[model samples]
Target: MPLQFQDRVVLITGAGSGIGRATAVKMASLGASLALCDINYDNLESTSKLCGATTPKHLDDVDVSSNQEVRKFVDATATKLGRIDHVFNCAGVNPTSIPLEDTTDEYWDKLVNTNLKGVFNVTRAAIPHLKSGASIVNVSSISGLRGSAQQAVYCTTKYGLIGFSKCMALELGPRGIRTNVVCPGYIDTPTNAGIVKGGEAVERMVNGNALGRLGTPEDVADVVAFLFGEESRYMNGSVVEIDGGIKGTVLGGQERAKL
Candidate 1:
């Protein structure tokens, strides 16, 4: 009747906030044992407290960018939880919008390391501990599907992540470990809150979608949960967009209406 993850272990990166925090809560509510990590220990602690006393949880301050940190966390999770059933690579960064020419080497590396290579690091470390029926959901962005002004580096990382996930899916498919990607647009979380400029920009983003509203972290989290669970067992190497129907066209009349 309900989504069931009882006795299953879920390893989540960037679990301190945004979609990662929301997914941790969702998995915990479904009775999953969680291994949660974020670069910020204080925020990670807050997320752990939000998961409540009932959820079996392990907390770590981990920068997903570091292969060493990721490997240590992955090993610790396997040791503490015994096995890993699902992985949500929700750790990422959105840099300030800037001209491509003005983008600094440091800025480029920061986004690439955290957004793309970070997923690679975690996935590589977690793979050995995963077995049949294990699921992996990498959080991407709609920017990866298309492109955006002033988001070159961020978009590049996300696009690369999609490709990487697809390869993993094909490679892990025979082994029965499914890999998928989630592309979320205009999610109104602390992550986006830091970037959205003014009320006008917010209004434009809200109206740009068929839903005419910003999506919550919970919205994306729901889809991630489905991908992790048996409900989406047949899905692999799938790239799902969690946008609120942004710029989607409806097929009907000569002048296509927006969906």
Candidate 2:
């Protein structure tokens, strides 16, 4: 049977683009109503349009890093949408990579605040409103599992998110609330567009993945949908990897051979 989300109220951050937008559209199609928030109002509007007639309550210019903003959004979502059955914590930023020596305090804070603290803010605010059987899916990265050359700050934030999600799962499990994180590798999202724009870079990314292709936003969205629904009712505190076997290759040093 197809996974169904009839009447579910889903709260999604970063719904302006990439995995967040894709998930919103997917859930909308599955009959779930949406409450979408994004720092980019224009992009968020575009995403809402793509939701195909289901008017999602939009909170624009919501910086997830701000607890106040996050709380306001969550409160509005619950008050407007009724209840938040699922939360997709997908609002994150990937700045250009810099070496530790070159990294500035501002850069570190930006990544940590947006990537790690943002998750905390959103989840914290939504928890009080999330009823039993609710699900929270956080968008971590393959970098969360392993370190990259010049991504010390980014890695730290992602790794911290994993730990945070696990703890949330344990604490919330008794309440019938599930918390899980998704780790995607080399997704062809706008966030990574600059890195993969060159043919050579694109080839390297493809060859690095055992699937021989980068993942699409929909690819990650499908997993998010599963985690949000009864299909993954038994899943909690799970760290799902949607990396197309990249974890095995990258961590096992198989990618070294290709280089």
Summing lDDT over every window of 10 consecutive residues in candidate 2, give the lowest-scoring window: 250-259
Model 2 gets an lDDT of 0.83
Report the lDDT tens digits of candidate 2 across residue range 1-259.
3437877889999898888999998998888889898899999889988987645554566999999999988898888878889999999887455778999999999999999999999999999998899999998888888877767888799899999999999999999999999998877776674343557776777777778987889999989999988889999999998887883433221111110
Off by over 4 Å in 1: 1-3, 194-196, 248-259
Candidate 1, residues 1-259, lDDT tens digits: the string is 4548999999999998888999999998888999999999999999999998888888999999999999999999999988999999999886566789999999999989999999999999999999999999998888778776776787788899999999999999999999999988777775464233546666766776889987888999999999998989999999999888978431111111110
Clashes (N, CA, C under 3 Å) per candidate: 0, 0
At residue 221, give the lDDT of candidate 2. 92
